[model samples]
Target: MPYKPTVVLSAIEEHHSDGVFTHTTVSRARAAMVRAVQAIYPLYFETMSRPPIEVSDLMARDGEKVTVLVHRHNNLFRTPQLIAVEGRIITTAKATPLGLIIKGHRNRGIALAPTELVDAVPGWGETAISALRARCEAVRALLPRETAPLTAGAISAIPDDTADAASCTTVLLTSTQLPYEDPVHGCLWLVSDRTPGSGEDILNGVLLAPPTSSLVSEHGSIYAGQLPPYTAHLPTAAALTYAEALDLAGAINGKDPSRGYLSALARLDAQL
Candidate 1:
């Protein structure tokens, strides 16, 4: 069988009668959900754990008795090596009254059933998990070729203190805007591949430039949350770890090391 793409699906089902996705609330909720998927994916992939297929819901008529039903689906493995977990965050008073409940069914294999009723939007949880899964799929597709020895781009130097002393290096992530506040001095820089062509060649091109003095960089700006910048100029295998590649770009840029130098070192160390 062809290898299926590994995914981590998280869905949030909201039982909000209000019918409104509040900007502030949704943003914060989404962030939290993304964080959960990020934390869970690594664990799931590292240790293969597959839970039995189950379905349950908190019914308002139950009057605090949360009811859930689970049935093992045939051909379960068809869904990729991905984690598809979802939850309903009901803002209504009904969801809050029932708390969480677990019940076993005789029809199914008779495994311990578990369910929870939380006070939040279910869609937030679902979307966050889905986002992580989708991102993982995308990254897998974007895996760089291993044939080439990763190269660094020419490093550009920027003055530490601009004419106004409020000077800072403008870290650009390809075309994205990843503005770093303060960069470290005389340190390495890192960046991610945003443009077409080989990431190594692009990095090498940036590194070949004159040394930069600014302490700001924007390596992981495009995928800011997922991929962050790293310190450049460290002795690590090129094209190995994602963090290292990013840091290598920083070193090549060298336009603003003061800020990203230490980060690069840490990222490189993580590769070990």
Candidate 2:
């Protein structure tokens, strides 16, 4: 799959009948496959105990705003749709009033993203067969369908830089809609949370170390697919002092303890 493991799944399914389709199969294998790839590459999420966005499901939501993750959608250049060329080269594509302008590496070769299928020329075009189509067909002939869901992988071998950081894993005091650039964990952070609903009494807390807890900076903004909610753009402890964090959070919501979660984050502020 030249495009992406996920995108390759989409392309192969669109043209060839041999591909992953079963919900349970995809569900079981997705994290494992993702984790395998993640072992080689640094995955955004510290843990992935969830389902992935299927391309078939994405096709269902035709025009609505959906998070388009190309190679994880970690770094999108303003435009959601970028160019994926053959020959192991990935460039970019931006829509102009005229048409989609595709540019090669360093803007060396420029071309229009072809709307219709033709001889592929490192430009955007519909393809009946993906790079994985032949390999997929061969693999299907070799393996049993039952084995698809049986595949599994591990992240135990993957190095953890935060090995020394105390796993102050505590209550689910908060859950952010968008990810902040974690200083220690990189992008797409999932801070430890614990929420127990079995009893009436609830004890809630979160892991907040001054070194790895805060966002990259307060001046900068990050985008997943489109603009995240205003609340997602939170202040980082590195960018502001503890007093500033408390003041800003209090000023926003003005609630008792619910005045934006920044007051709690003030503990992580290394400045002042």
Candidate 3:
């Protein structure tokens, strides 16, 4: 007898108006179809193995806070004159006698100031503040559905130029991870940056997979969105190291290594 495909069996099962076929016969046919497909495509039926390293996996294992470093860019200023931190873009406003007031739809047009606004323009006061509030709303709308709510906090702003050292900014970490299209593999990596663009430099755009790995770091350089001559941000305890970053890329590519340096680091850090 000739083999029957699932597509044909499914059609027959759907058009059983004649009531000549029994449920048992139909079930057997469906089962046979599944087996045939599996036999023909065993590779596709096999389970997709997990990567050696993943951001969530590392976070779960380490329980350490990952520091996402975002480079200040002009594109961020284009939308809402906002600053990116961790996973959010935020603007600062002063607390008036009434309270901290932000005029925008996201904040319901008025909100108590979380902290004193820094980098406040001198001449452009309320107008500037209102514009920023609007911008904040616009950026908020772009947030992915899986993102957590925007949480207010403080962050360190590292200047791109060596002449200027790191400064502090009272900002919010949206705690929301933005999805970036990795040009290299055409996969999606959740990155933290307020502005959208390409490049490895922190000043060029956003950063991904912290503690060592960045969207454009040499250790694991996963982001293909930006152009070449990729320069990575410095690695810190809060970010992925070069080896760990590579492992992460490997994992994303469905390559699981027996052991990764990140696991060793975690073990060493635990001992300390």
- Best prediction by lDDT: 1
Candidate ordering by TM-score (highest first) = 2, 1, 3
| Count of clashes, each model | 45, 0, 10
Q: Candidate 1, residues 1-272: lDDT per residue as tens digits?
A: 52122224222223555668532211222222222222222223332343222223333323232222111122222211223323222223433333222222212111222321111112324455455445445322221111111123322232221233121122222111226632222222233233333231122112211122332333322222222222222233132334445445556456543223333323333432
lDDT of 3 by residue, 1-272 (tens): 42111111120233454689544212322222222221112121122232222222222222122211111112311211123111112223331321211222233222212221111211223454454344334322221212111121100132333433222111111111236732221111222222222433332222222221233312211232232211112111233233443445454333422122223223222311
Q: TM-scores of all models?
A: 0.19, 0.21, 0.18
TM-score of 1: 0.19
TM-score, cand. 3: 0.18
Query: Model 3: how large is the Cα RMSD against the reference?
Result: 27.4
Q: Show pairs that collide, candidate 2.
A: none
Pick the winner on lDDT between candidates 1 and 3: 1
Distance from true location, Cα of 265 in model 2, Å: 22
Global lDDT of each candidate? 0.28, 0.25, 0.24
Candidate 3 wrong stretches, greater than 4 Å: 1-156, 159-237, 256-272
